[model samples]
Target: MKRYQFNEITTMQYIFLISGTQIGIGILSLPAQLADIANTDGWIAIVIGWIISIIASTIIIKTMEKHQQDTIFDLSRRYFGRTFGTFIHIAFVAYALLASITVVFTAIHITQVWILPNTPNYLIMMLFMLPGFFITKNGVRILGRYAEVVFYLTLWMPILIAVPLQKGTILHMLPMLKEGWAPIIQAVKTTVLSFLGFELAFVFYPFLKEKKHAVKAMVIANSISALTFLLITITCFIFFSPDETPLLIWPTLSLLKTIEFPFIERFEVIFLSFYLFVMSTTGIPYIFTTVFGISQLIGKKDHTIVLLVAVCIFIFTSFLYNPSFFHVQTLGSWWEKYGLWGAYFFPIGLFIYTSIARWFQRGKKK
Candidate 1:
């Protein structure tokens, strides 16, 4: 029963962690997804989505604050007692596992589609999952460092995306929200999936070095994600006709293909290579959070075994299933529905319950 040291991360690292996690494979198709629903005004949905994400993130922070230095597992136990709390904890672990699966599989699927069309899916999943386990096993500090590094390394992506706008038609974005509020609301629903990673804040909240700054970090992180989504979505809208936009999957990557350089051929190939770093930032954090949550629930001080178990399960499942493009999209759509519950609805529900419970306890004390 050896206890490992808990690694703490700075507020800034926390911000990068949340931002990097949220901006994953979903961003590749976000513009097209929104366009299908909201037309050119999809960026408006991003704004609305950001606001919703920020509010949800703040609630998560406040919830964690109520149980200082305790992970969600500990808080659940305190609120629900050991038996039911462990059940709740296990449920969250399951949710985190589903999230990690969605991320790694999506990344592997994208790699196969864009880079190595002939590469075996298992190989791609292993390549992504193995390195992630190595990083994740070290705990949150290492993860925070990896996220910060990925952010600096890929900062050039947005600028590269902007290059395509030179050929874009500004008029394409005109007649704003022609379809009005309904479509934008629908687009916001889709955008909520894109903002999925912030909810990981619950697991990582106790690891923040400056816990008081947790809300601020979450707000900044969600804002960065929102701004990034807004930029890429607007860039795509102005560049492609509304009808043309929804037809192209991975609209962001397609935009990269439009950029040509004298020395470089197939610019997207290079972009996708570096983008693996970005994708790992999303997957590894979820993997760590899931494994760590299970460790806490099971009273394990050493999480390495749990990590290995989780990775092995991921590999086994990914190896067994070879999803087609349409199947993968459908799978992701289903996960997004689940994500809304685990990320947004769960936190809000927990917060309200905790408040009512706390009020009852105070009345009893008086």
Candidate 2:
């Protein structure tokens, strides 16, 4: 039950962890969701979404910088007062818990569909949650390092899928913006979900070794995530007809299945194994953050105890919404709207409050 010091993780590690967490299962469905809105101009939507994400992320980083020693919970209490801030913390914890549940269930659904049609869904949930719980049980620094390692698989899988450009038709993206700007802007809202994990920077800032470089890490993480997602969106749009893209549940996996390697008959089987690692990299941190925040709330500094509570919560919630696989998809779409609200708006509001409070304090000093 040792308490760890802040400033243990380097800026690069923070950037990589944030980018890795953001890029998870969202990438699989983004092309279809964006296409549903923007049609063939989904990539434009992704770009616009990235612009909004950048602005939001910048505000979050600046707010964290203003209160270098304090967590977001502390800042909220300072600005919003004790009662309101406690409510805000409860809201944050709820959002984090729901996000963890959504990801676990989504992973279970994906596994049931693509990998193990006959495997019991609960078993699949346990398989994914076990490693994540184990890692987070160690500490945040351990979790950050593990995320960096698994992130390589995240990069490699997409590159391997992208190698089949010969099968992709650049013409598929043609008649660009034929539907006009409104659809693209609408699509951007959906695509932006892929970049949601960058807000973790606010929570992780105190763990950064170079505090001044936190903002740089945040920007780099978002930029890399945006670029990776943009590539996926454009490549998928070009590779498959917009009509065909929506037909596939996991379009990225579908893309891998289409790829034929000289020695490999099924690229997807290999891809899924590595992709599971990437998915864990994305999911484990959300659970970790939730646990961390809860521990902070209850004044518990023991990582193992906090992690056990998180594991129990994940296990409990993972089953609470155990409808069939189709129901899981429906739940995901519904949960996504809340995801957007929690991940995007909550931090932005906090940033605004912190900024105004800082200005007032400075005015009083002057």
Candidate 3:
């Protein structure tokens, strides 16, 4: 029996939530990022990254399992004490906020460039964020439902990606390991950004309905995302020449441009339009987590106040300036670095610390 049933999400919801989070704005540019380092072998880096992400996500799940009913907020306080725990919470909130902002910027940038060049950035953001506000305010159940819906809604996306393969050169992807392991290993760091969303398992783990299946859920979620990345990456690698691939910014979207149908023209526009649903999965989770963290810090049960505050902050920040494409990419690069710290290093370090602490406590009791 769960103490708070409102927040408890089902196993499938858990899977979709994490999967949706991982497949965000990064997908549009991941093929380019990987191509920059590994050339045609970039798809290999995505595989390696997926394996690493699965391991990392499993570790996070194990750590949360120790304190089955407690959120990461409570776990940090338990491990680090009050003052330091508060500091850690603030840092996570910052990470989540920045991640959300990056998604917003990416969505706006793509929308402006591909769809509406003349629309005001702030106007786009306002329309963009409205659904997030309404969805996030309801609670994790609503968020989970939204993730599930979006997952199915976009399920056909990968199939459409294959349309570009008719023109793709399969030979470009041959000669595997042509650059040896160095570049592929180096490119693994870039793929880490694509795997960023899995870390949210920490916060969501306690809400899982089937606690024992947490690892299985994570594996499924991550594999779905990994396969999607692989298919898309491979498609891009095959579709573009080695030298030509890295030059294009949004290779995934560019591939969609090659898609021709009797009824539709400029297919990339339609893809980008529906992609807002995909992007929302990323934005909503981060924004929800940020506000949830803030509410936890203040010991508030109701998250509505923090949610309102977060919305105001997000909207106010959008007013500052419209960033150029380079600026958006720069911000994304920084967020990836920050995500490395918050998502991987921090969780792994904390898990080790918790394990040691528990071992010592048991030894003392003996």
Candidate 4:
């Protein structure tokens, strides 16, 4: 017989959590980025990038499978000595801290530009963090449930996107791979980075109620993210001319402007307003993972204290440092570089080390 943890999340919740993490603020700008590098062939890059992400996610799952009941933090301690283990935990702490802050700044910048031009960033941040603290403090189950709900709540978006496509020209994307395969390959980095949320499996794997579904869950999560990006990226390619696509900073959000209804005049604004639910799914996971990792590092059963301190520190930091749009952009650039290494390169290294280490152990036992 198997015993389940008191606050375990189901396989579906696990899928939603990772997908929600991957489908954040990046999607708004990804089409424009791909357009810059690959021109009309950028959508192809998304598919390639999706394949790479699936492989990386599978590697992470395989690494964690050796320690089914332990998170990355605990695995680090077991795989490496105490000193090196603590270093990896600290690295994760820093990554999650910066990642969460970057998400806050990115969302704040978008909200101010689209809706509230007059509100202070700190005030907006306070509003965001309050609910964030409440949700994360409850535990992973709440975070998982929130993600699942947000996933369903935002399903109407594809139908809404279809409204703009009514006027889109399919000719812009007709000559696919116009410049050959080089541009698509180059643009794969951007697409892979957009799929960054899958790394959270390092923390989420242990909380999964059913261990057998880990790889399957990752495949589902990455597929949903890739398909959604394909929809958005392809929509942009068909909607805008090749020359015009690269010039836009947020082709996905800009696409929303074309939506029309009897009651709504500016559709993008309404769309972004509801998009907060989607954004929270990203932010809260980082928040929970950061606090949860810290609690485990310090040997605490409850993460509430660390969560409280982290929230207070961020709220206070917001008061002092109000990043400009350019600042946020620069921050995101740095985060992407770090994410590429953290989520991709590091996982492969860990998997190699794990395999060798276990091999040596088995040889010694025999």
Candidate 5:
């Protein structure tokens, strides 16, 4: 797939793209998930994870700075040669596919439970899958545009959450660190899992319009996500007793239950319905990156065909397997382990390798 001038995304689109991806289905359960492990200290864990994400993102940008026009796939081929690079690309492609389809399945499961209990998983999958294809097929710029649009559309959501907070108690979060940092450290893994989507910087950095601003963009992206997650984490802790939190499956959704809306009966249903768009902002980038990586691997110009086929296969596969909440957690466990390697360790390792190799090349030239 050849890169086009239009494929480049502006700094704002760039910020929204990475941040938007980071804030997906995870937000619904993250506060409760963290509270289960660390009590009110879970929000602290999110801060730790956010700092870690920004550091890793900066490393990723520094790695790509050497070849500002090349993506992870291109870098692998440059430094590691064709065979190893192809293997590396294949590994990433598989990871992205797992993540993309897992996101789709998770979204379907959430929607089924909250809004459409009677709807078949396949029917719901189709509804989600179609938009994914159309959103990603146009390429990254469209993805940036989609992400930006979704970000603005959901900006008013804080107001929806504010009504419930009035009833919440600051007392619930007091006596912080009752169990000490041990529990907070245990919960870091959960927050890091929520922080998983920043790895797309591997794909996005090459297309960034202003390379000088990449670090700033990365900070803004992580800050936006960290703040959003932090706010929700604190709200849930304050709104629900720490003991009551882990009991509710989607505490953030339940947080809205306290809000008495004039026009709507179940506020969660309305919120979940609109969140379908938010879910797309999360999944579409993974889908786009998956197809793009595969196309570049095979030296194909037309990733649109690849995108269509992958989406259809995913929709088809959903009919065979319908995951419950426990099953979704099982899927999340797999992603968490894989994501640590794919999104975290891999970039740091790659950056070191490239820097050393570049140093040796400069020595030879000297």
Candidate 6:
């Protein structure tokens, strides 16, 4: 048996890794989704969602800190019984797999719509998955560094396309909360799905070189991600009417399509090139988590086989839905909701259980 040692990644690199993973094609459709729920007041839901996400992320960080070097899987097994812990671990892996498939499906759908209309969906899916598998197989440290480099493309490209188009009316956002608090609260629930990847911090926590600073890094990464999503959501709502936003499949890209730079003929083309980089970063972590989860399950430390298995599963699942855009979107939405539950709710429950168990053990020791 070959043992592969895990390298510790820098706090800054981890920050970018977390941010890059969290911001994906989801950012593209979030305004439209929120609009569907809260109308023009959708941005309010985004703000509220961020507040909740921050609280959730803080709990995750604190829980990891209390356990120091233990992975969430180990902590779960220790806090809950082995049976319950194994169940939660399986749920985590399932959520990661579903999320990865959704990312691949969405990437293919976007490429088919915007860039490669003639390319077979499977071929495009292969192109995206292969590189991510190779990188993640190298290890999480490599993945974090690669994500750091890719983060620049992901962060700047959307802004480059969006910042120039600040020409729309802020009034479009007005008649605030017309549907009242009910819809705004529901929209906040929907918007929570967009903040899905913060919990990845739990999986990656053991690899941090500077464990003392991990919580700070996680906070910074999630804060930046929230601000970026908020800007994109607000920009889309301001530039396009609520009616126009939901009609278009990818509102962020649609907003870019309307921009014509002096030197650049089509801004959407520039946006697409950078968007691919973002997709790669976003998709790689899901692949890493899937591989990591399976490796832990089978007691294998060699990640190469795990990576290959993950790629095969992702490619196989991508084909399962017959490449229908609506089918992919619906499946993605369902998985996104499930991901929020697993990533946020399940882990928090484990944390509460762990705290109670520790308290009981202390009392018994006394």
- Evaluate all candidate structures by whole-model CA lDDT and list the values in order: 0.88, 0.78, 0.90, 0.90, 0.88, 0.80
Q: What residue runs in model 5 are displaced by over 4 Å at the alpha carbon?
A: none
- By summed lDDT, the worst window of 10 consecutive residues in model 2 runs over 1-10
Alpha-carbon runs more than 4 Å astray in model 2: 1-7, 316-321
Candidate 2, residues 1-366: lDDT per residue as tens digits? 112374277777888888888888898888877877777788887778788888878778888887676666676787888899888777777767667767777877787777788987667777887888788887778888887887764667667867766788998888988888988877777877778887777677777777788767778888888888888778888888988887776787777888886887877877887788877877887887788788878887775787886677666766665667677677677657777887788788777777788899999999
Give the count of colliding residue pairs in each prediction: 0, 0, 0, 0, 0, 0
Cα miss at 69, model 2 (Å)? Answer: 1.9
Please give the TM-score that candidate 3 achieves against the real structure. Answer: 0.97
- Kindly report which residue stretches of model 4 are placed more than 4 angstroms away from their true locations once superposed: 1-4
lDDT, model 3, position 137: 92
Off by over 4 Å in 3: none
Q: What is the lDDT of residue 173 in candidate 2?
A: 86
**Tens digits of lDDT, candidate 4, 62-135:** 99998788788888889998999999988987788778888988998899999899998789889999889999
Model 2: pairs clashing at backbone N, Cα or C within 3 Å: none
Candidate 1 Cα errors over 4 Å, as ranges: 1-6
Model 6 worst lDDT window (10 residues): 1-10
Name the better of 2 and 5 by TM-score.
5
Cα RMSD for candidates in order: 2.0, 2.4, 1.2, 1.4, 1.5, 2.6
- lDDT string, candidate 1, 167-286, tens digits: 999999889879879989988889888999998888888888887888889999999999899889999999989999999989999988989999988999999999999989988988
Q: How close is candidate 6 to the true structure, as a TM-score?
A: 0.93
Task: State the displacement of the C-alpha of residue 20, model 1, in Å, after optimal TM-score superposition.
Answer: 0.9
Summarize candidate 5's per-residue lDDT along 97-122 as a digit string, tens digits.
Answer: 87887788889888888899999999
List the candidates' TM-scores in order: 0.96, 0.93, 0.97, 0.98, 0.97, 0.93
